[model samples]
Target: MLTRRTALLGATLALPAQAQERFPSRPVTLIVPGAPGGGGDFTARLLAEGLAGPLGQSVPVENRTGGSGNVAASFVARAAPDGYTLLLAYSGTHVANPALFRELAWHPIRSFAPVALLLTAPHVLVIRPDLPARDMAELAAYIRRNPGRVTYASSGVASIQHLGGAMLAQALGTEMVHVPYRGAGPAMSDIIAGRVDMIITTPPAVMGQIQTGAVRAIVQTGRARHPMLPNLPTTAEAGLPGFELEAWFGIYAPAGTPREAVLRLSRDIQGVTETAEFRRKAQEAGTYVTFLGPEELAAFTATELTRWSGIIQGLGIRLD
Candidate 1:
């Protein structure tokens, strides 16, 4: 008499559990919240190619660019909480946007499941060749003496580079004008043309100019020397101790996505990041793989979000 009820309940519970374990029976989409040909796209494409072999499904990259990646981020948050739709979220996704944007429907850490830290690229502080300062110490001293005479340009207002500049200025207890450019290209143009005093740009964006001797890379804002620019000293090495800023990229799933699914994705992402293909591609793009699994990535996000929030408020950065 009791057998019929117990059998059905057992079967019903086991079916979904089995399905969750199998995971990714269909093609998966890796959403890039930024334009193609950028660092975000590069990471997504590489991971998709690498993960396909292990997962036995095609992982395609779909670009959903807008609102500094908030468009794609929001799209993923509302997507089905399955393994099929994933996002290539960055430090910007979790940390920078919270303070930068005026109205975001979803909170970064609250809106997504932590997947893995794909990679990080350090920002390089570059100045026009004509400027007098030769290194970080000299640059800090010069800014202190000149006050607002020196202007630092960023890709745009509230961008990571801008924030880094603000943090740097704050740490040095100095003042420098902040010049907001529409994009990195324009910012670099002004730096090269001597229209702007300096800029902190990504390695790929500024490495060429530094090599060609158009702009001098005074120091990097990373904790250590970059493989691409080993000769250049980090800001800490250049006398601004504890000065480090990294443009980091990671993977995430919509919040409420099953824990098992997030684990599966995180494991596979770890596999992909460890592969030779990922390393080679990242190096070519002026990035390096620094994988952090779900727990670590989540904790890092929390710390970074707090860090960025304070920096934003202290500097009075705002979207509106």
Candidate 2:
């Protein structure tokens, strides 16, 4: 009886080893750090679809919204270092959060191993139609001419839109008051009413406003103009060299995840991003593909983390 009981315990312990050898013997879960219907959620679902076939398993998306994404980041950080569990992270997770969340438990570099950097979404430089500015030069002139009177609206404090405004001010060698709204809706409404001088936010956030002629999209900070905003010139084309503000999207797994699994996932994800269908869908979704492998993602994140940390500090923007 003793021998039989000992053999049963040994078999139980070997089960996990056998499963680990197979890598993903079951479905994988991709956790998004935002509510459903958000940009991150949309990208996560799209990526999940592309991954399922290649992974030989279903990749389900799970929304873990709250705590300004720390909730999801910490959850993934604590998850087993296996390929089965992954994170679909936003640029703010590293670039903005580190400076804001002083007590952030998960270090972007230490807590997770980057699988791939998938896309970069650009922001639009929009202003109320009543403003005399119609282009980057004109806008800069208007902003400079107005001095501290010009105002920029954002979804909230420390949001990408807010940072973009600050960057714009810095690039133009001027200052614009930051007006934070509870969300983008209020910001849009006020901007339409000419209550705010400008707003730098995602293309989607201002696409309709631009179309309806409520807001003038003078320039967009993308390599190429968005299909929906063909007339909008990119920063480079607008004669604003090196003045680009974009949100990056990437995938990560818990640190200590097997290198083999990381490489495998990265290669497959690269393949996914390269597909014609994926490209079409991603562009339509306002996410421009810019794939980077594990090492590249790690290095890029580190550089961005440093740059944004200083920028945040200089701006004196802090959030809980």
Candidate 3:
């Protein structure tokens, strides 16, 4: 009787292992926590396309936009703990939203499992071409000279763009009133029309305008220059040191997922991101591919949350 019981227990444990080994038995759904045609949507779609062949499953992306990405994040937290449902979590969804929303249904670290880091994009300090300030130094001087007269736009309050702009102001010791918009597209439009004095926007959103000379990209908020915009100087290089902030996106699965399943998914995503096609697409989107493994990705998420919390508190921003 004892030997038979031992055999049954071993079989039960081995069954889970075997199931994990053969991951993605069916179609995988990648959830994008933003509207279609935006960075999160585009990135999720590309990841789905890039992961299909390697993972031996059809990866379909679904957009769920609301509450500044909290809606989709909450949905993912309640999803089945299988590898089929995955989340494309960006800075706003994973880090800032938790602090910004008073009643966020899911905890970023506790409610979901981190798979891998996808991409990191630096925000560009952009202004209308007609603005007199030509570079960061000039912009800083102008803002100090005309405090409260200039307004900066961001996609939303507590967003990376918002924190980036606030951090810049704190470092430069100047005051530039913030104007929050529903999204980056509308904010960029207002900046182009001269409705907003300047904006801290993503490179992908404002790259076309910068190329056309409609908006002047004075500097990028990163530690080093991006390959796509090598000529553009970093914010630290321009004047303010320690002013490096980049928007990052990663993949997550619902918590309590099988450990082996999470490892398998992470390996697959790392492989897909390192592929030539994925790299090319990422570069074209004005971002660099940096896939962090499980432990590193979790640590990075914690750091990002802390960084944004400080900025939000300092700026006295509250979405609630």
- lDDT per prediction? 0.81, 0.82, 0.82
Q: In model 2, how large is the Cα lDDT of residue 144? A: 90
How does residue 252 of candidate 3 score in lDDT?
92
Worst 10 residues of 3 by lDDT: 15-24
lDDT of 2 at 252: 96
List model 1 lDDT by residue over 123-150, tens digit each. Answer: 8899988999888878888889998688
lDDT of 3 by residue, 219-272 (tens): 988788988888999988897777777788899999988878789889989999
Error of 2 at 317 (Å): 3.2
lDDT of 2 by residue, 186-237 (tens): 6888889999988887664566677779999899897788886787799999
- Which of the two candidates, 1 or 2, achieves a greater lDDT against the reference? 2
CA shift of 16, model 3, Å: 12
Of models 2 and 3, which has the larger TM-score?
A: 3
Ranked by TM-score, top first: 3, 1, 2
